[model samples]
Target: MFSTALQSLSSHLPGCASSGGTSLKANLKHITVTLATWDAVWEVYLDPKWARQQLRLYGAQDRAMEQFFKKLKKEISELSMKRHGRAKQRVLFVGAAGIGTRGDWGGDAVLWACCK
Candidate 1:
């Protein structure tokens, strides 16, 4: 199930200049699977576009990076599962208004909570 979601997200990710870039795809798959376990789905919810962007920006096509992502996913999944129940969890981000501060924080915060 998690793999399927990762694949779906990989396909949806933008800026794939290379057709043979399965490395990024694989990394994304691993991350999503890990997140599924960890309950970090909130991160994705918080900045879905940013998450996708990271995948693209990293452009990792090496085994080392793949392993790193896989390990991270595993750790995150474990931690998230331990902290949060198996059921989906939600997170909310509230911000205060200030002169030099933009309201950008609330959008993703609200998105993350609502997504879960």
Candidate 2:
């Protein structure tokens, strides 16, 4: 299940060449998450502010980004399998808010590297 999820994620990323378990990038996009908590279900993509409030109340404040991606990947796979549809849609990653780390894609180099 993890490998399938990783493959699905890799194929959707920009400039990634996947072949039998290579490397991947961890870049993230701005995605809205749908979550149900406390008798209210939220489609948080439309309203960030409301989502934040609800997530905070639901005790997901620390892992909001993780939750977003988890839900997104699952939904993408499910939708594609259920409808026989394509899951290769463009995603917009707004701002540097969700970046896990700082990296350098050298000014004029070929390799991309990130330092932990």
Candidate 3:
């Protein structure tokens, strides 16, 4: 199950050869994780505010949501580093141009590199 989920997330990312923007590549391995579940699990591992914000964005927050986010974050971070190595990679935002709403190429690239 965990491997499947990781594979799903990896498939959403773009390959190094892809010319399209990072968002499209990054979204290759898509997984719909509930905010509540994430909060409940991550809260114990991370800050409550950070976990709450992350879960709220996904609309999945629920009571007793703690540690999960922290664990998830640690796992993801470790996995990402393992995949991409310790070197810092550059990301270029390729989507629309704006402040908050604009697409983040750099962010997408980083995510793809880390998650893939």
Query: lDDT tens digits, residues 1-116, model 1?
Result: 75677567767766864547568557767776886767565655668798777666545433344465456556666777888855343333345423323323344543433343
| Candidate 3 lDDT tens digits, 3-40 | 66756766776474553565532453343345336776
**In model 1, which runs have C-alpha deviations exceeding 4 angstroms?**
1-61, 87-116
Per-residue error (Å), model 2, residue 15:
50
Q: List TM-score per model, in order.
A: 0.23, 0.24, 0.21
Best by lDDT: 1
TM-score of 2: 0.24
Candidate 2 residues lying further than 4 Å off, grouped into runs, are: 1-62, 85-116
Could you give candidate 2's per-residue lDDT for residues 2-110 as a string of tens digits? 4567668767875665344434333221111222242344344457897677657545533454456556666766887667765554343434333333332222211
Off by over 4 Å in 3: 1-63, 87-116
Candidate 1 achieves a global lDDT of: 0.55
- Report the C-alpha displacement of residue 100, candidate 1, in angstroms: 32
